[model samples]
Target chain A: MNVAVTEPVAAAPVAERNDRELAREELTIARKYIGPFPIVMAAWGLGNLVCWLALWPLVMTGTLSLWIAFPLATLNVALCYLPSHEAQHSNYAKSGEPLRWLNELIGYVSTIPLVLPFKTARITHMDHHTYTNDPERDPDYGVKAANAWQAILTGIRRRQPGQPNAYGKLLREKAEAGDETAKRAMMEGLAQTLSFWAILTALAWSGYAIEAALLWWLPRHIGMSYISLFLSWFPHHPMNEQGRYRNTRHFHYWFGNIVSFGMEHHIIHHLHPGIPLNRNAAAYRELRPILKKRGCRLDGV
Target chain B: MIGKIVQTIGPWGPVLFGIGFLAPLIAQSMEAMEIAAPFGLSFVQTGLLIGTGLGLAAKFRGRWI
Candidate 1:
């Protein structure tokens, strides 16, 4: 099922509200937004098991070293976990406690195998969806530094600079100005990332140190970052067209489909997050005619 | 182009596939170690380990392609 669009209109801007007050609103909305939780959880659990079982033998064997295991491991990561992302947005099934449970389950397995907490991921991911590309508000919304050297220097800078990030500045203003929900979201995101790492450290302390590092931390934090950099950077390069269909290039094969989990239909996803991954093809088919009429076409895998 | 084609499918493909084929055998060896308890790692574990290792190494040779 798709992410249900119950109300497609904008709500009031969250400004000057207290945390408790905003949280109450968030809870009310979150309850409605959080759809099928159980099915998503089970599906993710089974998918994770299959991926681990399928590749673990290879890694356990001398035949596949850490290098080979890395890519094969990602075969499941992009495919298996992306659906969890969709589920987090309550797109997997219709709304209910069952949906919430499924979201929690799927979110937990997908990242925890890599040692991230479902609680934190869900919170940050919600921020990501709501704030999409809004540099002033979104956590994942990043900007290019003035130059390559500036960017490199910034990474080594070790502090949120006096010349703040656009998002950081906005968040600072919002917090100082008493935007409770925004402040709470920012705080929760910080807590979530911190908690995820804390859990990872604890897992390492527990006997499964190697597994914890390889399966949990390295892939989620390191490997996925590298993959995302390449995926995002290339697609949004200056040479790419401004038009939707021409903006991104699809690899156009089963491998692409398996890897992206229908994200290759990028434009459609932005237009309608409610469309399920399985239904991406049908959604594209239906929307293409209308979109093309408006001088926009969605590229397919 | 021809060289790229040959490098990929001719040599690289077989080597990767060979590794995939031998993965189960290696797993069997490692699992066998625990299974072969009490008698230091029984002949079964040693044989499986050595056999799988040698088989994979042989497969890596250019002639195997």
Candidate 2:
């Protein structure tokens, strides 16, 4: 007589396990709209250039005074950060394969005005996304300061020697860790900085020095300051340091979204980086209910 | 043909297009200022400067209200 042996139930089949994983992944798919992205970016670039070209002649001729041209130029310069931001995310040109290089090239060219290298910006930005509001770890902690003024002050302080700036220190650590990407970013940063100064020096030697200083250099600095204040500081100031949903602010103003390229819906971006810039608002609308349940803060201009 | 154009020009197509208009404008501005061309930048430098400037402006406009 054979003893009745109870066989243990076999584990879930491999295909079933794989199916479960696929289902979980599908739940995270974001709504993405990429049409008109390339056209809009191109138009913005062309418009700014046309504006500058038109203004330059008028300013030199005294038909349009510097007092007028200066502000307009500053506005234009400040706007340059948006395209570069998109480029950093590799979301500007969303056609197909072989377009990755186009994304990177746009990023680099667009950031030239800010004297920022694409790789450095990208690496630091990735860190910002990862660490978010952690004062000790986030590269963009200055942006999450208690107030806008505090954020600006923090940025200034961090740039000073001996300050515990997470971004700079993290770059150093990454280099020491033998991260090739970090190494390349550092080298690019140095090279870009030098290139910036070299261009300025060349301009000064060429006699268009004053023109370059006033028209080109000064506006970029002002634009950068504006970016730090509005883009980084205000949007992130009220965000909680913990949890993905609580860590970003969403603004529901159409005009604001238009100007900021849907940056106002930053919460959606933080939650889903794959969504293109043009589609952030749509994505936000889709996820609003879930985000609301999670206690995400919504604001407007 | 469309893919070829996009690939060849890449993301710089608009910028290059903008430069085409900007170069002449900068040259005119230099003439108005009576400053002789420096660094031999007659057309190309102006195009670059204006193109870069415009790109920066577009960036700001996109973000700031």
Candidate 3:
């Protein structure tokens, strides 16, 4: 991806006279680009998962070589998080809506390969949105680090038995305080984690150890690194700034937007969680000028 | 009884990780390199022995690196 960033130009002040008119215009433009239902994201989420599932059978049955399947599986795991992210925002359908079930279905089913619990992901992501760069409260704060390797290492360290994981720690504290939603998140997280290990252990013991490792375990670590790097760390790097636009930046990743799962337009998502993932780029294209005028951290486009 | 066994095992994670994850992977790579374990032991058998030993060490001692 083409990760690009230059020094952000200091924003020009909005004149009081034109501020209201400009703000109204910007709001109208943004709403127009909320765009259509994320059909593409839904397909990407489901199809990537199916393709990952198919890899296991193909490798086991000798239809495909492990050498090739490993990369494909890694790609699948990396692709796993975005659709569910859409679900986290309730971008597909709002609460009490009929298609909410579809939103929930995609949310729950899409992340199975990564073994992330839907409710857990949802609650923590909402926290992330609410407290994007808060060191103490943001569930993603653990991903903050000096560089990419540190970010990846931080992701790994958090999963180690005794190491502190921000989301897990937050959920545990909330559950202890008798928060019902936190309690559900804890249960789902535990079940998913156990299932992941149990299945991996069973497969390994049955002599598919290499397959299990490549298909799920290692891929999970790699995918988490990718997700954490692009989704959390990169967008919100030097993550101390507060407020709507300052907390996230628009930068082109060296690997390009696709590899980063279109997070290059992440600033837009933070500003309007309702904008579907596919529409962020187009929205950002239109909204960039307004963002610049407001002194958003639009370092790169 | 189950708790006793679980306690006795201390941490089963490293042990399982060693045998289930580390061992087989190492064995596969070793075999690919045309290397063989000493005493005519199969590569996987050697890996299991080593992985279990290390896993148990980490289990009791806490931490894997």
Candidate 4:
């Protein structure tokens, strides 16, 4: 289905006289929720270290069976990565500075690109919120470019107006307008893809070619990529009557929760971005009636 | 530290037990049932029960104890 191409609409300008006043008010509210950033940062970091170290031996030695490895590693990503996500939001720690540091650390160590600090992610994420589900302007919107074969076949088919592929249309608009987020995300994704492949190369250089191919290198890039894609993408596609609700499906299974950190409660998450993951269930329960009244419900797991 | 660890694992209790542990075991049990159609028991069934039982214990601990 073809969705309208949306451009970034100019934000309503804050009156110069009121902008500073509003900033102060927002800061006060932010401070009430943002507690001692250092303690939270230290605690989260320590907890992250413990979890990773706990898994290191099993993963390194290959003592755990492949099935166990799959689940454990996925869990590990949730534990460690959620903290990173929280850090990005500046919510993990009550303090802002420490959260920035934590996010920066993760950005560097994380295979993903360090696109921005907490403040930036928060701002950009908020922008995502305001323009959410907008097929064109939503930063995360875009389909994988069709492969050469598909592109050639599509050309031969000569798709009629309003019948062009959704992905092809999105790509065409993204290229023409040169969306900044799409460019930045592609750069980061490229960097991550290369860094991961480099590890495999290093292992080959170290004479553990076969082991690396089977273990760290292949599973993370190949298997983990597939897992990550499905976990991240499918739930948030076009799904609302207004096509505004970001596709967020919540699954109440342990594996599902661990895989996405209850991200499946995605609709609720989009509605209440500040609610901690740990508190989502309670919040969801409380908000259920209101959501139902609005005719919104969580979709597939 | 122990308290923190418990706290760490607390919020995830339902998921760890109900869905994560139980779902797989149920799947396995079904598979085993198919394999051992005439037998009194099957390895898959045993594995499923063991896995689910452990998960159920964890879940019970999380919710009640």
Candidate 3 lDDT by residue in tens digits, B1-65: 53365446535778877876677766766776788788989888988888888777876766665
Which regions in candidate 4 have their CA more than 4 angstroms from the true location? A1-71, A74-80, A93-99, A107-131, A139-193, A222-234, A237-260, B1-65
TM-score computed on alpha carbons, candidate 4: 0.47
Residue A85 C-alpha lDDT in model 1: 60
Q: How well is each residue in A1-301 modelled by candidate 1, as lDDT tens digits?
A: 2334454333444554444444344333433423323344356556775776566556555556756666656554544455566656666554564556655556556553443344444555555455554444544445234433443343333222123334444555666789775576456545565565455445433433344345544455443443343333322322224443344433343456544445555555545555545555555554454445444434332
- What TM-score, over all chains together, does every model reach? 0.49, 0.65, 0.87, 0.47
Give the residue spans of candidate 3 off by over 4 A: A1-23, B1-12, B24-34, B40-45, B56-65
Q: State which docking tier applies to candidate 1.
A: incorrect
Candidate 2 lDDT for residue A261: 46
lDDT of 2 by residue, A1-301 (tens): 1222244323554244344342232234362343335546545654665676576678666798777887887777777666666777667564464666667666776656567777888888888888788777677765566765677676655443234545556777998899998887877776676566556656544545445556666787677667786777666766465567677788755456666545788787677665655577777776665566556777764
- Per-residue error for B27 in candidate 2, Å, reads 25
lDDT of 3 at A104: 95
Ranking by DockQ: 3, 2, 1, 4
Winner on DockQ (1 vs 2) = 2
Q: Which predicted model would earn the best TM-score? A: 3
List runs of model 1 lying over 4 Å from the truth.
A1-46, A49-72, A93-98, A114-135, A143-211, A226-255, A297-301, B1-65
Better of 2 and 4 by DockQ: 2
Give the candidate number with the greatest lDDT.
3
Candidate 3 backbone collisions, by pair:
A1-A254, A1-A255, A1-A256, A2-A253, A2-A256, A3-A252, A3-A253, A3-A254, A4-A252
Q: What proportion of the real contacts between chains A and B does each prediction keep?
A: 0.00, 0.00, 0.26, 0.00
Residue A45 of model 1, lDDT score:
55
The whole-model C-alpha lDDT of candidate 1 against the native structure comes to 0.47
